[model samples]
Structures are given as C-alpha cells and as structure tokens.
Target chain A: MGRYFFHTRDGHREIDEVGLDLPDDRTAGLEAVRYGGSLLADDPHILRHDQGLRVECVDDAGKLLYTLLVTSVDAKENLATFATEKD
Target chain B: MFDRDMAPPGMAIFLAKLLSHSLLSTEDQAAIAALPHQTRRLEPNDYILREGDRSDICPVLRSGFAYRQKITEGGGREIVSIKIPGDPLDFQSMYLRTVDHNLQALTAVELTVIMISDFERLVQARPAIARAVMVDILIEASIGREWLLNNGRRNALARLAHLFCELHYRLLDTGSGGLDIHKMPLTQEQLADVLGLTPVHVNRTLKALERTGAIARDGRGIRIADLQSLIGTAEFSDLYLHRDQP
Candidate 1:
C-alpha cells in the first residue's frame, strides 16, 4: 500500500495536504486524469490551454511523484502530458 | 416605464452602457430610465429566484456575482451560468411563467429589478427599443449555444481555460483590474457545480494549471498568466461573443 497526495488546480488554487492510499504511482496518474475528467464533466462550459488545469501527485514521504497536464495546441488535439522523476 | 429618479439606482448606473451597446436612442433610453423598479441587497448564498418561482421582474446585477443553477434528477445541483455586473438575471421570465433555474447571490449583491410589465409596455410603445432588446436577446442565445459547445466537446483543461478567457473579455467593460485580474467569488465547490467537476477534481485541475503557469489567484480574484497559450488550449474565439457590433 502506497500513500499519495494529489493537489489540484483549475483556474484557481486548491491544495491537498491529506494523502490517499493507492496501489502505485501509475494508478495515481490514472486517478488524477479521472479527477480531471470529473471536473470537465461538472462544468457546463470550460477551459483553455493557458488557463488549462492540472494535477500534482506526491508520496506520503513528501517525495514528488509526478505532474499530469492536459494540453491541446490545436482544435483537433487533446493531449495528456505527464512528468515524473522515475519510472 | 420609469423616469431617471424612479429607476433603480443599480439600473441607473448601467443604463448608459446598455444604451450605447444596444444602439437604442435617447428616447428609448428615457423609456427604460422611467421604470418604477425596486432595489435590494442580498447576503451571500441568498436565493434571488428559484426554479418554479414565476416573477414578473427582471433583475440587473449592479455589483457582485450571481449564479444560475438547476437541480438534477439525482438530487445534485448543477451550476449552469455565472452572472456578473450588468447582466439581466432572469430576463427570460418576461415570456416564461415558470423559471427553469435558480438564481442566487454568490456574494453580497445589489440587485435592481424592473417589472416585466413596465418593460414590456415600453417595448410596445417604442419599436426601436424593442428591436434593440431583441438583438440583445439573440446575443444571449448565442452565448448559450457556445456554452453547449463547451460542455459537449472540450476537455477539462480547455473547459476551465475557456471560461477564464470569456470572463477576461467580458469583464473588460467593467474596467478590468489591470488587464488580467477580475473578481472571482465562486469557491471551488461552486465552480465544481458549474464545471460539472467535483471539488476534488477541480482542486487537481487547478494545481495542474498552476504548475503549468496558466493562472494564478489571490483571495477572490484570478489572473490570467498566459493569454495566448490559454486561448489556444480552449480553442477560444471571441466571434461568438459579438463584442463589436456595427
């Protein structure tokens, strides 16, 4: 069991001080994307790339796990960018 | 209709802007300026108009934020739209008897209300004003269609960014605070209701956007960090807003 904290931001700020237990960091990344999807689902209308939103995941030991970003440069593209220190 | 003194103070402040933008004549403006309206202040979270409440008055948001929302069948509240300064909250009530959504003050608000009967009476008398009002209504309809496009197609990041872009552009008339900052009174939970995202999800999206240097917020205000890139992500186009009407 691993503990992970996911900090979220839309057009504003929200910090996640409490961490949650997940199977692994991969699962954490997936969870964060799902979290983003839920946000997209809730608002009737939404975002832009510069105002685009994202998630940050950290381990219980305060180690940075990974950063997840959803970006779209063209109208036809929606890409997810994930940055992490380790495999 | 009201004379200058009889009109709600809130409505009076926005009259010139509305007249100039709608392209109505001075006499037409006089007609609206004469309305026997009422003004009131609401504490935050107070319900201004709820679903099923049929009111004959159309409210003008003089200051602060108001929200439009509907309740889902599953007993969840979904925010439909946010109203800022100079908006006519529940303008549709002129024709419809039952309100489709609830209007609430998201912050302490000053609302000036004009009775639909008086407004309609003026419209009946002045063909030009009526035409101008119709144009305004059409513009609002177009904005709604754009929102439909936002919800049905855009991804999460684009969805939030698009909203910021729209606000930045709209608030320009309100004397935008140094080109990028504006009052953002809605909490993440309220924003979540409007965005259809949970509070937790909104938190993550915000954190991600902050990390990417897209936006920043302090207290009840938000600033656009990167305009062009944010616009690119949302595929935002101001054409639908019709900000410039010849």
Candidate 2:
C-alpha cells in the first residue's frame, strides 16, 4: 500500500499533511473523485457562478497522481441563443 | 476462590466498567472474576465477530479498541459504534441466536472470551451483575440514539467535537486513570465512516476544530487541546452515557 495526499481548493487551498494509505494509483484517483463529490455535496453553492472545486491527489514523494474537478455551467444564455436561432 | 491478583489480564478494567455503572457487591465481583475465560489477541482489521455468525462465547474487550459496522449493498460501510477497552464485545449472544453486525478490531486488541453458558449462569446467580449488564446495554443503545442525531442533524464540526467529548468521558470512566488526550485511536477514514462523512470532509472539519482551539494536530493523531471549548462546540451532555450510578 502507498500513502496518498488529497489537497483541495475551493476559493481556498487546504494542503493535506496526513495522507491516506491505498493499494494503487487507480484507487487514489477514485478517492480524489469521491473527495470532490463530497465537497460539492456539502456546499453546492461553490458551483453557483461557474466556480469550481478541485481535489489533487499526490503520493508520499509529493508526486501528483490525479486531479478531480467539479464545476457547473450556466445554461440560461445558451438556451436564449438557441431560441433566437430557431426563430 | 479466585484471587484478584490471579485474575486474567484485562479483567480488572472490565470489572471497573461494570462497577462504574452499577454497584457490584464483593461476592458479585468475585463470581465475575471466577468465571472461566481465555484471553485472545487480535491485530488491526481482525474480525472478532462477523454478521450472521453464531457463537456460544461472549468476548469482553480487555484492551485496545474495536467498532461495530454495517455494509450496504453498494459496499459502503457505516460504522455504528466505537468500543473501548473494558467494553463487552458481545452481550447479545447470550440471548440472541445470531450476530447482527460485524465487529472488528481497530487496533491491536486483547479480549477475555467467556462461554455464554457460564456467563448466563453467573448472571442468574447474581442479581447485581445482571443489573449492571442491563445498564451497560441500555447505555449503549442510548449512545446509538445520540449518534443518529449527531449524524442526521449536527454539522460536521459539531459531530466531530461531540465524538471527541464522548470519547474523553468514556476513557475517563474506564477507571484506568490514564487518559491520553493525545493518542486518539481512529483514523480519518474511520472517523468519516463513523460520522457519515467522507475522509476529505473529516480532514476539513478537523482543521476547523483546530482553528477553534478545541483540538490540535499531533502527527497522524489529534490531541484534545481544550475540553471545555470542545464540549461547548458539541453542545454535549453526559446524560446519554449514564455514568452516574442510581
């Protein structure tokens, strides 16, 4: 098993000093995605204005393994343009 | 007659836990000490009891920590309760036919395993011990109810703070008189499972608690920096623990 750190950013950067032990990089990638989902679930307002949340997974040697990003797009302007095109 | 000095290792702590909840007479204590039992040790992640397993022995945790958890169909685990040293590992087996949840060691654990028949005989012969056992089970259920409220209603910060406060009080009640506020036993992943949150959220909440001066980081573990502040943050009450004897 290897130790992996998940550093996060959501308008603020929080460096993870204590890392989790997992079997491989694939598992670390899944963990990063889970972390990003949890962040968004806890506070969906971060995605209100197209702002994004990021989870960066790094190994014990400070090597990056995976990055999971969660964001949302405002589709109201796109819908208006589509309506004009239809007209 | 069983000599107190010759009692099995970890027996004193188990007796002390019962005595804390109910007054056990000298005879009752002696009967408990005289019960036939064997000591067994387990490493971390070792399963003491698995779901749906039938066993005739009830194990009392003599030292180290364990937890009860349930797994969902999707393979997600939810930890229901944390067991400390001196806690009875399987009181339900005395009356129930099958185990309901998985019990695993969170650290290197030592357990005093007693036959269910022997325990049942002792409980029938002694009324005070029976009362003590009942109180212990009731208190565990009460803690479960509080955990439900903690996970369903409280925020992450309050949930973490409340858990630490509960642990502090429980360790103090063990009567061991050696409560180490620094060496917390649960990992972030374990804490997340307990609180119904992810490890990332657990980490963030721990940092927030540190900022409030309720706890401080100590390497991989955390120290209870300010108990009063933590209690205030959790809005914790000891009524659920039922430490005071009636």
Best DockQ among the predictions, by candidate number: 2
Model 1 residue B82 lDDT score: 76
Note the Cα lDDT for every prediction shown: 0.72, 0.86
Clashes of each: 39, 0
Model 2 stretches with alpha carbons more than 4 Å out: A1-5, A19-33, A40-52, A56-87, B1-9, B177-182
iRMSD (1 decimal) for each model: 5.1, 1.6
Residues B143-246, candidate 2, lDDT per residue (tens digit)?
99999999988878899999998988898888543224536789888999999987777988899999999888766778788888999999999989987775
- Clash pairs, model 2 backbone: none
Which ranges of candidate 1 are over 4 A from the true structure?
A1-15, A18-87, B1-9, B174-179
Rounded to one decimal, what is candidate 2's iRMSD?
1.6
Q: List, residue by residue over B1-246, the lDDT tens digit for candidate 1.
A: 435445456766556336535766667767677678778899998999988897988888888888888887987897778777777786677778898888999999998888888888887899887776776677777877887888667766787788878877766654424226554566777767877665566665666666667787676566788888778877899988787863
